[model samples]
Target: MTTFQKVNRYKKIIQDYINKHPEKNSDDVLKHLLLRHIPLNKDSEQSLQALSKFRTTINPFFRELVKTLKNPEKNIIEVLDIYLKANPIKKNDDFFALLVAYFNSFEDLYTNKDLQNNTALYQQVIVPLHLYRERMEKDKVDLACELLERRPVLKYEDRDLNAINFMSPDYRRISSEYYENQRIKDSVRKDHRLACEMIRTMAIPKKELGRVITDLLKKIDSDDSLVYLIFETLGSLPIPKDQQSIVVTKLLEKVQNSKNRSDSEAAVKALIKIPIPKQQGEQVAGILLENIYSGTYDFRSLVPKLASIEGQLERVVTHAIETASKSKPSSRIFDNSPEYTTHRLACESLKILAGLPILTESLRERAVDVFLILAGYSDQQMYRPALEAFREMTIPESRHEKVVNKLLENVDSKDGIYCSYSCQALAVPTVFEGYHEKIINKLMEKIRDPNGKNIIYFCVALASMPLLEHQHDEVSNRLFELVDTKNSDDFGYTVQQAFRALLKMADSNEEYEKVAAKILEKLDSGDYRVKCSVCNVLRGAVLPERFHVRVVTKLLELIDGKDYTVMNNVCETLGKFPIPTSLVEQVVSKLLPCVDITSGHHSIDKCACEALGNISIPEHQHEVVFNKLYDRIDTFKGSFPQSVKPDACEAIGKINFNALQCPVIFYKLFMRVMNPDNVFETLNRDNMILNTLSALYNKMTPTERINIVARLESMQDDVASKQPNRLPFLLSVIQKCQSINAFSAGLLSHLPAEKAEDVRSGMVR
Candidate 1:
């Protein structure tokens, strides 16, 4: 028949099948027809034309099939057998592609007993695979490797099969006379390569394979390439722990002696796979230290591997500190001195060692001495590393007192950087816990010292302390006394710092109430700066219950005060507290007039929006709050300035739409933000819209969610075309909603693979 006639004939057959099975989609029917017909005329014009028509007529079924077959239950040999039987191509290229597809579908079958017992089926697969490899095509060799490396269910009785023989070359070379004769003819490196590949590919009995691998290791000598291959092979094997220790010992020796960095790194990599016994840790640490000092490899790469070896942490730390101490500071100005290089390496290594979770007291003390020496260096570069190292070290409880004393000595040092670092180190909660009362007394004394220049440092240290509820009254009383008596001209900022600490330390309602009363007293201060600072403190210390009401009343009273700074701070703090349901209307009424963005003071308007957003009420008030926020957004959309729009958007996003069951609000917000003209320019505004949609998603019904996904998909093309950068954000929104429903998840499976992956990873983050 003519080519056109044949193409027409095949198309009719496909169409008839699709018509008969309406439940089966057009794409599925097209896949079945192509699989049946392509192999018969793979290289013919008729088949090529038919393939082109089919491609245009259906979705990409082959890609979907590949993904489906990756699932373990669907990747069975029976499924592959059906496909192979239907698509019987003759051309080698087409046939190899089919074979690869089949091999890739072979899921891990190591524990499939029924398949293991089916000897007949094993023979059927083995004979054809062996013949295909014997053809010796370059691609076929790779295909053979891919198939043989899989965990096969074949038994030892199948050793006679050529496919099995191909995978067992190392075993045959060591244990069989014929293979040994063949190996003698090959180059030494080639033989080693073959043996390593064999070990990697074959599932030989453990006892026999272990003996062969040991013998091979013994034969490996000065050849770095062979040693690298051998170590890599050993890493993949499931050797027993005792055997692993022996392997680690041998690899560590190689790591120390090998001049080649790659070889040493490979040996280290192998050692990491094997567990070193606690007793061997010191020896292992010694060898690693020697390699590190050799300076042949990047020492940073070695630190993590050394850290992974449990036990002997003390030995490693001590060795690292000693090596770092030997690195003298450079004397020359612009020369690349060995001393500088060594010092830098030492500092880096010390930082890593000190950061390790396990540390002995002696090792920590030695590390502290090294850090102090580095910290004392005049150059900021030298001291910054020391500060970082000290910060990471968890000073033991026993050493906290000693460390605190050492830090206190530095607190009065001439160098401001050193004093700052010392104060920061002492600020850590655990370090401060041991000396809380003494530190508080010392800070109070320093704050009271008329000539004391370190009051700021003292106030900061006090703020950093983890004041317990039991100590709250004592600490608050002392700090409050400073605030009450300190002159606003001399120590106003210091007093603010004291109030900051007091606010953080206060825990109970009564404690917060006392703080509130003091704050109210400060609000009446003549100095606007004092009132403003008090307002900032109040933002963080908004009390619960009746105290909240009282605090709100005080903040509201100050909002209309004459000073703009005081009014701004008061409005900002008022917005932060969650106004109760009874007070929502009153609070909203007061804040609404402040929402006028055209008024020169945008801060007041911003704070008003923020406060209104934070107003807490029953579900019944959702529409009220949403409409007020939305009206502000609509009013500002085109005509108003851009700065105020985000405040309005954020305020709208923060409203409790879920409680109000206001899906339509979310839908409208999404459509507005996703408008093609608006999406790219307002990418920063997408977060608020996404959060709104996410809240709506949880409250949506199944059918409603499906409709949402459909709408998103419909607009996806426009989004990609106009705002390609927002595609990931768009997909993330859909994925978050669809992930809860399997039906929606399947519907979204057609999204680009990378985009889908980005969606998943974004959700995980």
Candidate 2:
């Protein structure tokens, strides 16, 4: 078949499937798009290239695709790898348009250990990330709006990505209704009613939603289901920071008196997103706790709602303690499903308060009781958070002496994480408080407890120990022993820490060499902690410059280490040492690979990449790292983590000017970051990007020199109105503009006064 024929054939097949099952198509298109590279054909190539056409064609499916991508085709995700290899851009968000949404769809929220090393997932995640560069060229809004309107036909989930979302009939009805009900629709009350309809129609699950769109429209005008929709769509709306609390107050009043369970539940869930302005949140929490505890209302129905206060942390804490005191404490506190979530809510509330404030004596005491009781929790889901909260609260303080001692006394009786929990908590300041000897002696007493909690306990304890607090102690001696095994995760962490402390206090060769050997023994440890400790010990050691070679070797072991932060971290530590050639090569190679990593292709991996840049030696690694970094910086489409990209950009500019004497790379990387697409998407405010621009301009091309005047002029409005993060980048651009014009005359024998002042009005420097 001809290329167009094949494309048309696939498009028809996809559209046919979408016609049969519309809802399923949303996820399919997203899954298809996130491929490491999208394969655009003769048919869809133009559509991908024309972003406005793509968005309009895809808009109807936007909501559905979001839902599908959210749930994902976990089993069929490998399919994305196939598409990514094709390098197709079906959509664009900002400058880097085309299937960028698909790239995002493939990302898991935090690091996904389950599929971390999976090569197929890697292909699905990175290639399009690389492909995004082509679509990110400079463009005007008219073109953007035009891209949003285009219809590109593509196969996703055996269906046409566009066909499934082509509910023209719904749009017609909505448009007609919009015109007929324009006044009402424009009104706030009707706006609320419309939100209710959207929730009942678009947001709520079909089974739970019960009524159809027409019925929902009538009901939402009077129902509470709209509350959930409002909160869910909160991100899309232009909500003022101050107006949130007031709206929340209204929602609470509505939920408080609502007769419908659905209405009440929706209202409570909506409350989760509202920022409670601390004081207002506390007031609401107080009312909630009192109402639940005073026996005025059955706590059973309100637990989930109360749990929603997790967002308003302080209020949640105050209310939780008050509720516990007001009501009788027993295992049966949560009597039903809704109340069950309430107990979990209280647990969550306590979870947030840990390490925040131990001010409330009674609250801490009760919270400790809650954690202990929950240690045996039947639900593993709740147990994890509760356990985490327990560990957080038990940091090296004796604030809960009675609780810690009580927990420690019974540590041997417990098994699994329960015992681990107690031992780890007891290792804190509370146990060792001015009684270091007593705490050290007690460490071996609970070694028998399973779940390895005691092991974790020692790890944390050793890390938190004061550097000069213990001098040449036996505890340090025991750490030396554990450092030898280096295989156990927790044990390695503990030994590595002890090494960090000893290296600082070690005054003589005897002490330095003693810890160095222990550090070396674990140099082969695959665990990042071991490698890091090995790196740290070698950092300040008086080891001969010859040791710098081995130190570089040890740091290399962590270069591509699974832990994202390990490579950059090792380099950072190594940078501190006075070193030579081998060290320079090793550091350069380690940093270059990070520039290639596309984890920051999404919002998540940016931090790791940024850290890589921060530790980089911009002066030396210039040629080796600059070009590839410039490419990555120029190509990145969406908002990246603030830390990584900026550092990368700054390092690139610095190395370009100081190392390579290439000033042009500066203008290219600067413009790419300054003009990122999706102006409103949350990730764009990477302060690091701006910091890099500012640093670059400050050092080499300050505004007074006015080198890249046009770009600065273009971004002037954005610089003024850009999110808080872009402020620094703008400042640099402006500073450079002003400085260039103010000082541009210095670069030449003959300078024009008119040209100089005009430049001064345009930039910051």
lDDT for each candidate structure: 0.59, 0.46
Q: Candidate 1 at 707: error in angstroms? A: 2.8
lDDT of 2 by residue, 92-178 (tens): 222123233333222321123323444554544344543332232112222222322233232222222334344765655455444
**Candidate 1 local lDDT, 158-227, one digit each (tens):** 3333444456656564346445443443344554455465455444444454565565466556445567
Q: Among all windows of ten consecutive residues in candidate 2, which has the lowest summed lDDT?
A: 136-145
Superposition TM-score, candidate 2 onto the true structure: 0.47
Clash list (residue pairs), candidate 1: 575-611
